[model samples]
Target: MSGASPRGPSVADRGTWPSPGAEAAAHSRRLAGVIGSALDAAGGWLSFADYMQLALYAPGLGYYAAGADKFGEAGDFVTAPEISPLFAEVCAAQIDGVLRALGGGEVLELGPGTGRFAAGALAEFRARGTPITGYSLLEVSPDLRSRQQALLAASDEPPVDARRIPPRWLDSLPAPFRGVLFANEVIDALPCERFVMRGGAAWRLGVGRAAGAARDDMPRFEWRARPADGACTGDAGFVAAMAQRLDDLAAAGVTLPEGCCGEFHPQLAAWVASLADVLEAGLLLFVDYGLPRTQLLHPDRAMGSLRCHHRHHAHGDPFLWPGLQDITAWVDFTALAEAGVAAGLEVAGFTTQAGFLLGGGIEARLAARLAPPTAGEAALGEVARAQLAQGVRRLLLPGEMGEAVKVMALAKDCGAPTAFALQDLRRGL
Candidate 1:
């Protein structure tokens, strides 16, 4: 199922991918036309970040903005929560610690995918007698919101009161907010500023029509390199920020060779800063697939970590289906840590997902499952045990989510929790 393309190796293409239906295809075509118009208005070139924004968030035609099943076998990709409920249980332990440290507070989830994690966490908190004032979701996709609502409503009784924060209210988050903030697999989706190192200079990677491409036909957008002109692309601030990050990486003794291409997320710093600004006290925890700057920018990864996922088909062609595919870039943990520090937050801990979850109590959960049932309780069945084992393997195996997924916790006045401290990998970073 894997193959190499002009870009690089394809990793997500697996299983029987269901083709997009007529409606979805038409939607993609419409989105492509919109992007084409924008490209033409921009003098036939648009920065990759702009293109990504339009592709994933452009009003109603974009991938996320459109109503599409995006989180299961039938969807483009699967997230950890969808994989197993155990993920939320382990996360609950860490969240409980943060809430405990702050006495008691609400839970702010950046993107509650299908509300699975929220449900699991709420159940755990309720079972443990932990008090959660509220569960606030900042989800942008109305389609996803409906799905989340349906899933949560089907539950007999949700432990905490849940509410959605309208996008317009994001700028006015509870002032002096004190709570636990969660962002699982969120930062990776933030638009990345792709840059190309060619001709002994770094040029911004933009999207534009192929040279002499027929306007009458479907506009074929391709990678177009030009001088790093941020103002021309309406991303002046991002240009300066990207330059600073690259300079910082070079100062740390890591540099990419000429003709190499990669991505840097300037929005990450700003996003972290914005969150830190309103937080009077709390912990910001994140889980995503990524690597440290040194490793991420190593000579081995010349093409960077940008990738696309469509119907579980992991590929590198972001230009193929336009708004129909999910585009992402691997997060730079070192960059994240630096940003947290700059924002006056402590880089409490960083480690692999396996380590974090195990420290937070995955083994104990497995042990409880493996142990014999108490009197009048049914023992764990063979099929259930096998399923649990499979989930564990997928979560902890090196070739699976284990090594690739990273856990990082940033804190305000609250110190690092013991759960994360157990396997802190900040030294490696």
Candidate 2:
């Protein structure tokens, strides 16, 4: 709901990006054609959410659907899990607490990128002697799923004990479950509806074919906006919903000026509610780059939080190479808390990523790694200790993921986890 910058870069900036290989270029062209057909069917205009869905999830040609290195140095960007095993280790401690409170339960992870978190968390659980009933992963991308499988199966990684439960891959959420549900950087990727304020009303921003504009025989797309108040045949509900959202922001002391642009995940409420339905009793934990609604919707961010990542270069052009880039919008945590309450869950705690890490004992973990080395091990130990310190800094520094990212917990028939006790920012929400 936060507004985007007033003067952001134009789509023309995509020219400075490194070009994809011939095969990747062809893949993008094919995806573009698919999108063009969808636009044609939708009267040459598709809501940004719909376009994002296609670009990221379209069968075999989408960014996530196709074969591409998506995490770590070889990919677009690195996640906390990829940065260090300490992230998952700390998270594992939190999960261990929840499982102990519940007597024992399973762990379900959404979008387990590369299975690094799973591997690390499983190891931590084993080290602590936590009795986990099971470990399940709900991943949509076959490509990433295969990668996860390989990583978890590798002999070099921590082994899943025979007495303990083995990891399972799930196509959908299991019902009547009681355990922990974890998602990292997952909500941000959900398809979101972009809107712009005009004449004190909201207009839906969408994608449309750029007339006569073609690059390498692939059709070009441009931004197009339509009044949300019935300008489009099926936008009546959108108009009402956006109106209520803006009204809520106004009540929270945030206002958007005319021409302000932003995005909101229309399906967020339903998504959270679905998770609530499946999680009969347990914790729903989410860690991502986000903020409370008021801070997120501040007027200064007139252009919104939409971003595209390709080969480590972040930009605003979602139109660049379509399926070849990752597109995401910052999350509105205030909305998440509201959804949890409406779904009959308790807003247990919400805090910055730094607070969560520190509370989960990152300092102790680092100290253990940095313990004085023996005579023969001094050199290797020094190098490892330095790397550990750097990774911890990235996770806890205010300018890094520390302050920008937030961790939120929603509980059902459970007490607030100690992980959030260090610094609860729920009052801001």
Candidate 3:
């Protein structure tokens, strides 16, 4: 979900994209049936958040729930860790500093896609002699968990010793846990509610059956907008929340023009509270593409940040293939900070990914990789060096993941991580 094509497809370009195979189409149809039933029970209207939740997490049908290759070259998108081991290596440095500060602690990773980061970090930790009590991954997808186990098992660089901690999978957040919890490009995937401002009122954008489409037809879907007031069956208090959000923006000297649309993660507060409830003392780190409220809800971005990806083709249509494509919205860092603070965690640091990497000594890692091979080591070929350099550029350039991806750290009874020392953008939040 990290390295999506910047230029998404338009309505006209949808036809040019590859068509789903028979099996994929049938899978989508089955998921559509599930959604259609839910829609029927909901009186033909379901909030976008509700639809998104089902599309991405519904048991055995949603995107992540089913068995699908969702990472790397063969998947829908490539994440930072997939881009290069440098990302995980630098992240390990930050985690190492925190663990050392706390004497010792574990590392809990949320949505550890493909186990690439876990493998790279474990290797780095072993090399640096970093003391970690354990390494755990909280993956919701059964398919993904199996894949993680397979990859980690086949890894050449296993734990330093048999006694050393090996990665374990978690069913839920461990209560009273003391560790470092981090997620890369995970928050953006959380279901969010889409809203549009019209004539100073907010309307919740949702999904419903297309006009005149028969139930027997290929379950067509369409956008449906309703008042954000409590009148809707499942949208109670939506109006008040929207109003409050807009009022807060107005207080900051920004106002959304009429017809402006955007998304907000409805479960952000509760989600952070859940993390806070579990961690006795640790850091919560989230890295994703987003901006502070002021910029995110600014007038310039009137169209919003909702995006979908299928086979590397980014588009704006979430209705194209339910439970088949990846859907995401840009994170609201300001909201995330507010939630963390409300949940009794201190805002440790906030900065761009580029800043975090540089602060965590990515330069040193790059230098070592570029260094000549040892007498017995294999030579670093010119092509491999160029690829490595290209990957670094993609991770650090302002126009790429560097600026788009923001890193935020929240802590409870822990010190600020060293990764945000280079530049702190907390003021914007």
Q: TM-score for each prediction?
A: 0.90, 0.94, 0.95
- Residues 1-429 of candidate 2: C-alpha lDDT, one tens digit per residue: 011111112242455678899999999999999999998998888999999999999989998888898787778777888777899999998998998999988889998989999999888888887868888999999999999999998935454633657889999988678789999999988898898988888899999998786978898999998887565544875786687788889897777999898888888889999999988789999998888877777688798888887766678879889899888888899889999999999999899999999999999988877877667764445666677787888788886678888999999998877979899899998
Q: Please, what is the whole-model Cα lDDT of each candidate in the order they appear?
A: 0.77, 0.84, 0.85
Ranking by lDDT: 3, 2, 1
Clashing pairs in 3: none
Candidate 1, residue 59: CA error in Å?
1.5
Clashes of each: 4, 9, 0
Tens-place lDDT digits, model 1, residues 216-251: 355677898787755575467656765665776688
Weakest ten-residue segment in model 2 by summed lDDT: 1-10
Name the lDDT of candidate 3: 0.85
Over all chains combined, what TM-score does candidate 1 have? 0.90
Q: Indicate which candidate wins on lDDT.
A: 3
Model 1 stretches with alpha carbons more than 4 Å out: 1-19, 156-172, 212-217, 229-231, 234-239
Model 2 stretches astray by more than 4 angstroms: 1-15, 159-162, 231-234, 374-380
> Could you list the CA RMSD of all candidates, in the order they appear?
4.0, 4.0, 2.2
Top model number, TM-score: 3
Candidate 1: which pairs clash? 12-314, 13-313, 13-314, 197-259
